[model samples]
Target: MTKFFLLLSAAAIAAPAHSQTSPDSDAPEVVVTATRAAQPLSEIGQAVTVIDRAEIERRQTTVLSDLLATTPGVTVTRNGTVGALTSVRIRGAEADQTLVVIDGVRVNDPSSTGGGFNFGNLLSSSVERIEVLRGPNSVPWGSQAIGGVVNIITAAPTEGVQARANAEYGYADSVFASAGVSGKSGPVSGSLTGGYLRTDGISSATSGTERDGYRQYGATGRVGVEFAPGIGLDLRGYFADSRVAIDGFPAPDYVFADTPEYSKTREAYGYAGLHANLADGRFNNRVAFTIADINRDNYDPSFGNDPSFIGRGRSERYEYQGDFRPLDQVRVVAGVEREDSRFNDGFTFADTGITSVYGQLIVKPLDVLTITGGVRNDDHDDFGSHTTFGANAALALRTGTTVRASYGEGFKAPTLYQLFSDYGNRDLDPETARNFDIGVEQAFLGNRARVGVTYFNRRTRNQIDFRDCSPSELTTPGSICANRPFGVYDNVARAEADGVEFTLALRPVDALTLTANYSYIDTENRSVGDDFGNDLARRPKQTASVNADYRFAFGLSVGGTVTVVGDSFDDVGNTTRLDGYALAGVRAELPICERFAVYGRVDNLTDTRYETIAGYGNYGRAAYGGVRLRLK
Candidate 1:
């Protein structure tokens, strides 16, 4: 699969030549939020990708997971169909290492034992653009940013009153509806959005008929005021409610028992900030206070005796951040954050809390040189305090070419469940890592053709693992009796992972675009006194993807994408290996009028059967179509 994608990418680059074109001829300018300042894609120094509203409509993507799955260096995993526990990983890092921000506010749950983002609750329609940074971003973002960052920027109000509506239906009896309104009057501007989505998911087994699935409804609103040329304040909030069904264990005939599992989630986030201009236009300052609350309730009927388990988790976070540019060549940003979290299984688990402080600095000595450094200190009540640091330097060699090198340290504090779980047996320490990366980027033909490659290495120490052991009378003052002793978490392993990635984008013609990416990883764990010391899990050896789009003269556009995933192991034993697979998708867009459009998309064009996660079923072939309206 990897070789196939490489060939495809090579073919795209070697195809028929065309005259060079100006940057303006490629596409319209897109604003990004990852840098905290709106800038065109060509000016941003980071490895960023922006998915604009037009692309979103053309692809007919209705969910955050759906959109991210198509991007390079990203993969999505879920425990079950709709509304299930879902997470995204970048490169080959753990899901928890990636940071997710919605409207400039971090939304990762502090109560989760694994520190992963909850993608199941994030809606897609309210988003105007998404900015993705594909490498360590600790210098700009704080903790849990070892892997990368994903920022979801919502739509802003228009100049005058405007309204729009959208609806869609697709395979598996799926239905969706959304509406939004935006307006500005005097010094005030605001936008309000609401939507609902439901789907009877695909069967958990090949021949199974039961359709245990999910339904969700959500609303969001944002308002802002401008007092002066460079001063403003904005506030935003969001709420959602959802219910999903769980898939039971597979039966002898690959059938799954049908059962309804209930899960309700609610999130409210808001921020008030001031943006000011000083020293003419070269100096700027921004300060903001943000608050977020997340609550979740889960009821499952397939665990333990009487087959029932009820749980609730709540988390709240407060943040104060400020960034300043004292001069045109220097930018500094720093922030302090605190998180309070509580969890209950109706009984048995204690509440936990974590707090952290961090700061960063970015300096440019010359027009072609940039340096950045930052550090974070986390003071956890249970595991004490730990500090992490990161630094990077980049140099522009010549026109359309740059090289960068970076080093960073990361740490993950022990969760309450790991330290004080009901069945836990011992204490645990934090996990830590030191990472290094070097890369080069180039854009030729007046920025119409781009290529980038990066190499990364990470060494982890004190890695956590669960251990189970039985005690004898000599050690435990008990008779030599058999017992299924539960496991406990411990920091007892060391490991290293290294990888390389390559990306290319070319627009040889005014109406055609081609993009491709590839990644290869090698990982190993070195731990003595363990049965599977050298095992590698959750890491694929190689992966690749390619995309192409062409626009016709009659206001019609067609695009196709292909992704190939390589073999990976699920556990240390290496006995459970998932086979490699390739999947393809195609999309079409037709403009009905200047302000209206219709789009259709077909995923898994070959009806391929593959699993991104072991023991979890994935969707096969599916088709969807929708209509989009613009009030601009």
Candidate 2:
């Protein structure tokens, strides 16, 4: 499989060059997360993957994480079924290091142990677009961007009134449905979407017998009003409520098994902004306020009806951004932001705040060359002040070649839970990292085919990890473990990751499209411990996927995808191994008249048995069928 990927990559690079055009004309051409401003793909030096609504529907993906797994430089692991604990890692970075933004609002949970966003309950119901940046970018986004950033854009108003609805049913007693509407009238524009899903999921424990169930309800809304030519007010909001049955360690033998245990999560975020463009769109300014609130509870029927555990997290942010273009060749973007976060564990409460200011310069010294530089300073209430810098350059040649390079620094403050929880440490320092990458891409066959390769390296220090207390330390007075008996969080680990990514896209003919990408990531723990030099837990060294889709002249479409992953150890000590596996999926859509269509998909077509995490059961072969309706 590795050899096949390499050979395909070589063939693509060796292909003859032709007049340059976009390899995928239908893909989103503008990206907003790279510089906190909309920029053409050719001008951005970062490694990014853009997935639009058309691509999502083509694959018939119901879950957002399932779609993200197909992108390059990304890896996803779900503990068991659909609604279990899910984590996404980029370029071998920790799951919590990735920053998640929805409609321009940060949604990381401050009350969680790692303060990361759970992708398990995220559905593709109202998502219009998704942008994944595969390297550290702290200059514009602030903390928790050590790994990279995932920016999600939900449904928005269009030029005319439109309505869409979809419904599906499948194995495991599952049901899914969603509906959305968007329109513009005069100066006002608005959109709203609602989604629901429920399923009798597979057991979380490998040895369990009972079936676990899951359910979710979600909605997204956006409204905008233009008062003047370039002045507008924007409001956006999102909410999701979910409940999932989970397995737990039983009391008798203390072994993993099915139990009457469940978890519930409620998440909501909102954003409001006022913007104006002056000097004929040369100078733009925006003032925004954003808030995110999340609540989680765990219950055990044997222990009564009340929740056994409860957690609440909330964040409020105020920010101002300005963009100025004095000349066509130079542009400047600057922003100031203040964010406050609070967390409660039903028994204890804590709060923290951070203030930051940043500025970036984008200059086009030549028509084909673009360079960008930026710096940021953040003042945390507990961790003092820290600074970060980043730079990147992109060069495009008339010979159908483009070269890109970037260097970025990342700084992440400790989460509220890590600083105030029972096992927390107040003297912990912030985690930091340095990331670099370079790549070259070539267009061939009149840009109907393209090939690209990139190399990236990152080093992280002062990584926070839990350290168990020794017997002597527990007995010593005034020690770090004076009160805590089990363990404490401390900055004790260092790590490094280096990887290569290859991408190929081909449009051999007008009706068929094929795309493939392969990633090889090497990660190691460099901390001073017995586990030093060992590969990071659950991080496979190689992952690759190939997808093809064809649209017939008879209003019918068919697509299929195959994904392969390499083996890796499941523990930092390299004791247990989790063998890798391959998965295949097939989907077809046929239009019935002009406003309705029918779709069906078969996942795990070969019934391959695999597990991303140890001792967790994965899905088997399943089939689903759905229908879609559109009105304009």
TM-score (all chains, Cα) for each model = 0.87, 0.96
lDDT tens digits, residues 1-632, model 1?
A: 65465545543443321111122254634544334554444334445566766666655667787667656667676665666778887766678777888877777765466656788767686887787776666544555665678888777888989887788889888888888999999889999999899999755433345675778888878898989876788787777777776665444654455544456666676666676666665556666666556666666654423425444455556665556777777776666767666555545566666677777677788877877778878777677777878777777766978787878776666655556565432356777778788888887887788788988887777777666645652256432222425545667667777888887777767787777778887777666665435546766777777776777889887777767778887777677887777877777778899878888888877777876667667778899888877775
Model 1 segments more than 4 A misplaced: 2-47, 205-207, 227-229, 250-262, 272-289, 300-307, 423-427, 472-484, 529-535
Choose the strongest candidate by lDDT: 2
Candidate 2 lDDT over 133-229, as tens digits, reads 9899999999999999999999999989999999999989999999999999999999999999999989988888788899999999999999999
RMSD of 1: 4.5
Pairs of residues at least 3 apart in sequence or in different chains that clash in candidate 1? none
On a 0 to 100 scale, what is the lDDT of residue 49 in model 1?
Answer: 63
